[model samples]
Target chain A: MPKRACYAQDYTGLKILHTLYDSCLKAEIDFLDDHYLLNLIVDEGCIKGAIFLDSHTGEIIQINAKAVVLATGGYGGIYHGYTTNSYGSTGDGIAVVLRAGGAVSDLEFVQFHPTALKRSSILMSESARGEGGYLVNSEGERFIDELKPRDEVARAIFRQEQEGKEVFLDVRHLGEEKLMHLLPQEVALCKLHEHIDPAKALIPIKPVAHYSMGGIEVNSSLEVQGIQGCFAVGECANAKVHGANRLGGNSLLEITSLGRFAGDHAHQYTRSASNKEANSTQRDKDQKAIEAIYAQACTLNFYEKQQALGKLMYEKVGIQRENTQLLQAMEEVRAMQEMKEQMGIADKSPIHNQNLIEYLEFSSALLLAPMIISSALARNESRGAHYKIGFEKQDDKHFAKHHIIQWKREI
Target chain B: MTITILRSHNKQEEAYPLEDKERTLLKALTDIKATQDASLTFSAGCRASVCGTCAVRVNGKEQLACAYKVQDQDVIEPLQYHEVLRDLKVNKSLTKKTLQRSTAWLQTFQEASLTPKDEKFSEKQSDCILCDACYSACPVYAVNPDFLGPFALTRAYRYSSDKREADTKTLVDNVQSNGVWDCILCAECTLACPKGIDPKTDILMLRSLSIEQGYTDPTFVQQSFGFDPNAGF
Candidate 1:
């Protein structure tokens, strides 16, 4: 029997992650789950190692290492209710850096995908539009060109929905066989979750929170600025590789190419490094405070607060934003931050507890909200994915450089 | 509607009232965690079946929690053959061990001008999300955890069949012991795979490759006795 390899476009790029995971396994690299980096160990203005919480077993582990890479992805999940991010994309690394007084750039330029499954927020790839799929409003009119950049398309969709018009991806004319051959995964997802076949039906879609164009400020070697022996890559690093907006097929290219640069740099840093432990008093205090969460009485659930945050962000800071709306969004984030302490967890068990993890991620989300709003408010001009309706034109003269915010000792 | 979730750690079946109208198993379980109990643990990622982190046993079958719809009454638990880390989350440490045993990575990083043809050749097997559905469903592990299992074997075949690999002998050598041919061809893996990649066929192909290199199944014994030469049709 002759076997020909099939090459359907991997829209998610997750299958490649599996390959990398297998490679890591082959390399004998240890994967530690149920443990999160609580804080970056800082010594003599250099990142020494990290302090982590083994949430499963409820153990606080402090490791002294030579180099650390914060590839924990972007803060898309911080949008909470309507995002296309993984459950783990809570901006943990960014939050850690924020608390540690590390620098980050372009915290406000979040790229919202114009086409995502209406119910689940699962993204339908741009390849759909590339292959002649049209975006239709409730009146079945293609209001904007389907091939427009993400910001324009997302804004159009948002405006359509604001007018109470339902938006859909009309790929019915692509024909069934071609769709099945080219976008088998998209077809399967719609069929399984939406209970509709793209062959005969319109895929209900909306703008969903997708990628963070902002992240930990990194230099050419992908090392975090103002911090020694610490690196950031992928969506978590603001390399200006995507400029203001990310184009298709660039994320995979950027991460693979720059991740190597960071990895090689860190390897060189670690080769001649000696074991030196740093102060973890802050982490210890933070751990204690986090542990106290388990004992708190239930009041406002984290999920409800997260929904409120998501709704507030999508309305005020999302799709289209101006100074007044951004200021209000900042207020809402502040209010949410104030109320987060009252949010309680139901499961307090130390053994593989996801509730604690979610709560911790929620805390990270709380810290991240204001960062994005602050950056957005500071930049009075619009560029890339950061679009304020009033400031639609780019102001490279004044706002060309990065917006740096250090951690306030008091929130 | 209330959904009955079987907690593996406590060995208790608890029914939680549904709140989210999304009706996905992940949402329902998350609702339970948020409202009913905070201690309920499960691994979830992507929430779209793209990440294999949320694979669970729903109604005695393997399915991704984010992909599967919440049923009226369901017995949800952690996947089989893995040590239960907590509630619905299981320890995937063994999956790593088995993957290394199968030499699932490229034997050599020698450059190649791989085309769309090369990509198409290994496409089906490469769709593995490593959600461990096949690994959880494989009956071979019940008898022997040492058997390299489906995901790794399929990966071994994927890399070996790659046009870029200059040395497949290491991969073949890796799968020789407690791997490849040990798969009983149960076809449960095919059913369990959410991506619909057939590992039984991939394993069969690996066996053929092994045969080409003068290696047969360890159980293969020459039939020297009871040879009836004239009994053929």
Candidate 2:
């Protein structure tokens, strides 16, 4: 038995604190001198503006600011249950900009995490396998090579499951003592939730939808390609740093570094535009589109529709996809779009309802899903997470460049 | 196959033969129905560990009853640091209370400029499974029940780290007292966490952030620096 190290003992509490020790939260608490002058506005599209709705009664109030930045994250949540993104993410920033005639790129290429915790849908971070955890079968045989890349690992696991062998993560060698010290949360969950001691037993593992390797295509400056005053960063915006598969820990680097760069660039853009005012007619047009979206999203059956949309994506466009499934998913998305158009409106009272927000998110997912499936179908090569069993080989000859999906007039 | 179990209560070892090698714990107990009452108490659900209700102490270690492979001579007991409702079932109300005290819900601001990075900052920690392994593994909670503990502090950090949350000061103030700062930073919580969430780190981060925001351990500060600027002593 490996003697437990004390450094591994303080892993959970220390790791949790590392996440909270960011400059943003610190600046908000300690650095901000003028709390009164500080106007924190939500849903202002990355600008220092205020769109006020009355507290008790429904009313609209708007305020202008000197600068505007698009800090809206990536479009991963647009793929339903299969994303590493939080539930709040729905590609709202992407959709709003696209509607403003801003060209969108690389809407395809979603990255599916190879091994999510089987039953609970919790992400078993790749760091586990990366640190020497083995994938085993019911016969106690190590089925897949542990050192293989994520996409390969996912494919191998999927293949094994298809062959009727129940696969599990065998971290038993880590032992109860070390597991208790290093991965206490996971071990405890195994004992408590999954009813298995990771130290002594095999953890049931499966692949689930995770990070989107593709998003709104942006250049080096984090500017949305061919769109003025529009930028995206983080997982929502692909800066090409993640070529095919994103390296672990790169997400933090992308968000922090690219977010800062985009903010700076947006600040500069705002300064230059100080002399030249934004087109009033174009602003009015954008406002009308926003109003229309809000109106359509408030239907009584919107929540039901959103749930249906999630099911559709998870069932059809999930992990292993073929042309037949992709086509079927496209048809389902079309039907969902029609339903949204027909349901009209509900709750015109302008209350702070999350249902309406979810409905809007579902609409964005509905639009983005078909693009992902279609692109996945078109790219007849296996590279990264976009694996097509029908066309198995990684034919870099024809599929080297990134797949850019634009919203053409005709589907 | 005959198996023996040593009872901690009477210090008596009981043996009974089992029919199948792959027999479950429940089945084994059922086979030895003549020696003991058939109404023996334990917990099980899903028989796989996803439900988290079937944890018990086996052979002097905490193990999930569903996952643990029973042997010929293994002892069994209930979980510690909790009131046993019956044999193996612990009172879950304490963990639920910790969650309540932590206020793990989304705390939004009246107005705050949050970018994608700000929103994405604490996304990983938000996926807490609420399996109280960290609590059970916590030395502080075992010694002092009032230690706010790892799970609660991690949850507190989750909300406080959110850029959209308007009130970090209020959150910091709430955790300053009640053993939040008193954590010895032994990361047993990290080791016991199933979701790989590190509550120990969250607690430390909370302390550092709190101190930076002017919430200090006055005794420690005075002891270390011997400050008399404020009191004129």
Q: TM-score of the A chain in candidate 1?
A: 0.93
Clash numbers, per candidate: 6, 37
Candidate 2 CAPRI classification by DockQ = incorrect
Docking outcome class, model 1? medium
lDDT of 1 by residue, B74-154 (tens): 778789999887778888877767887777898787788988788878888888888999999999999997889998899
After superposition, candidate 2 runs with Cα above 4 Å error: A1-22, A25-67, A78-84, A276-300, A342-349, A407-411, B1-233
- Model 1, A234-299: lDDT tens digits are 998898899888887678878778888889999998887667767677578767877788788768
Q: Estimate each model's TM-score.
A: 0.94, 0.59
**Model 2 chain B, poorest ten-residue lDDT window?**
B33-42
* TM-score of chain A considered alone, across all candidate predictions: 0.93, 0.80
Q: Write the per-residue lDDT of candidate 2 for residues B23-65, one digit (tens) a residue.
A: 4564455335323332233444334233455656666565555
The 0-to-1 C-alpha lDDT of every candidate, in the order given, reads 0.83, 0.60
